[model samples]
Target chain A: MAEATTRERILGAADRLFGSHGFRGTSLRALTREAGVNLAAVHYHFGSKHELLVATLSRHIDAINAARIAQLDALEAAHPNGDIPPLDLLNALVRPAFAFRHASPENAEVVQRLSALLHSEPLEIVHPLMEGLFSRVMQRFAAALERALPDLEPEEVYLRIQITIGAMVSALAGRHPPDLADAPGLDEEERIDHLVHFLAAGFSAKPLNGADS
Target chain B: MAEATTRERILGAADRLFGSHGFRGTSLRALTREAGVNLAAVHYHFGSKHELLVATLSRHIDAINAARIAQLDALEAAHPNGDIPPLDLLNALVRPAFAFRHASPENAEVVQRLSALLHSEPLEIVHPLMEGLFSRVMQRFAAALERALPDLEPEEVYLRIQITIGAMVSALAGRHPPDLADAPGLDEEERIDHLVHFLAAGFSAKPLNGADS
Candidate 1:
């Protein structure tokens, strides 16, 4: 087995701890011990626990954003002239993250749980990092969605985008909230397809007021 | 001025600390100090920090659920025979919460943020309490949704219910994700109306496969 390096060890341990215990719940001392590193090594390497968090999140953000951008690029190439269907555009937003089915289940769970927290929580330390990572990517998708739905006011489009992200983040969090009925189990691909279809209809919904008409 | 009772004080302090710093981040010692009570008082009133969290959440849950049930009952009466429109059903889920607009903004913000976290984040100490509080309410809404959309499978109804909730929780959390275009501002009423329309369309969306058709 290839030995993990100190930085990699720290990041892995931090990610798991943060994902499970949350940012403030996981202390630096506990993180150091979990990483099998000296306390001083933590500060020497990452400056502080907050910096370590930003660093850990940055690593995943790079991977997720890269995958999303790559998906968008491929879709654009195939469609040409940006005549993308709205559902196809929504799929690009979610497909990369849902691609975790190919990864080890344990690793995928931790990443998704962590991704859900980072997106949903209001911690100051985490927000700027998440925004920085996602802003450009969100803009690209927004433009694509606008082209696909020319009738949607920019504001309406924005609300639907936010709602779409909310649903995606909730699914990634993996709680499977207690249901009144037997919740159907969709395999990973079907789950993604269901989410894409649901969100496409939501995005295509007409405004409440007659302003647009 | 009415002096706060020991129980009320403890609940208030815990709510703020938990809302601002999260459940794991807030400690018993800090909570006691902030509440202007001693260590013994915390245990005297709430047993432990975990119990304290349950209590704090319960206070809000009681109010919010009461409001929801009341709204649901009123809608059912007006539409009789469960012929309620899906948007009105969706409204019952959100209208009560959005009524916070008439209250103090700070109080509303904290409660909404807390609600979002409790629903989204998984913690052993927190889940059962939340589930106990919400399960019956969810079942009622699910039944109402089923009646409104007879074509939707029970499983599809359940999934859309989850998605509608995801959207509401995300909005309450209020991160205002970075966007390509300037997001429009809507008053509380307008926001709730927008959400109802968007989610109603989502719930009414056709299933992607022939299984449902």
Candidate 2:
């Protein structure tokens, strides 16, 4: 077998430890042992467990957020005058993370396992890694939301954004969802497609005064 | 001073430990110590550590799910068309849980903490309690989704439902969110209303082909 590269080995070990034991629960010894490298190797490469996790996750978060930003940008560029529905922004948010079933299942698993790890026994060091990553992207979404509904307060928009991200993360993190009765064959792309469309429609609907007209 | 009730004490202790440590991480010794009760009293009241956690969660889950069924039924009774908008269904799913906020902020904490706990840990006992509960409710949602967007399959409905729930739970769990942002006055009901409206719209939107599209 081709020998694993140094960074690959570290990432693989970190992924295993972080996924199973969480951010705070994982130890360097466990991480080193899992990586099958010398004890000093981690210290030499990453310096600390927290740094290793941040490095490990930086790529994934960056990729997702970058894709999300790009997606939103394209949608707005394509739709002049901001006519693009706000649900389009929501679609941009989720499809980038989950659309991985086509090219790489491993990528999808990393996002999934990380979602589980983030909410589960999170290491004390996770927040700094996520700093400004989502909010930067959320600004674009909030802008789109403001245009789409045109009725909600700024404070309401912020709360909605927070709750919206939470729901997306939860959906991504959920595993044993209720099985559909007599479901159709769904490739990875199709599943992601369904998610984006459904959420877009669901989110694009106009707000009401607690009653349907 | 009035004596604390055994059941009450057990529930309280279990909530704290389980919230902090999670299902597998929590133990009977920690629970009894926190409860200021003997092991015999714990065993007499709840039988096992797992049972204590279950008993603690039972009241909240029961309240939430019961409210869920009632809200859904009311929606059905009012709409009766089996065609409630996806956002409306999303609203029905979450608003009832918010009812707990009025009873006690602590109850809201328990519910939110448990959501985060479920994200990280699995209490096998919970499956038995939650299985039939969500499966049936999901079927109702599936029925509604079919009427709204017949283009998607039931499995698609199920996956979207998972995503929707994840977002809602993560928002409420408030475990790993943008806490540093300027949070608004956002009264209890307004937050719930915002969550329902945003999620409903997001989930209701049409599927996208790709981020590029």
DockQ per candidate, 2 decimals: 0.46, 0.37
* Per-prediction TM-score: 0.88, 0.73
Question: For candidate 2, lDDT tens digit of each residue in A145-182?
Answer: 77876876556666656665665665565444445464
Question: For candidate 1, lDDT tens digit of each residue in B28-145?
Answer: 8888899887888988877876577767766776788898999899988998877898877888887776675345454554565454445334556445665687888999888888
Identify the leading candidate in terms of TM-score.
1
Question: How accurate locally, in lDDT, is each candidate?
Answer: 0.72, 0.64
**Model 2 interface DockQ:** 0.37
Model 1 error, position B75 (Å): 2.1
Q: After superposition, how far is residue B192 of candidate 1 from its true place, in Å?
A: 2.5
Clash pairs, candidate 1, are none
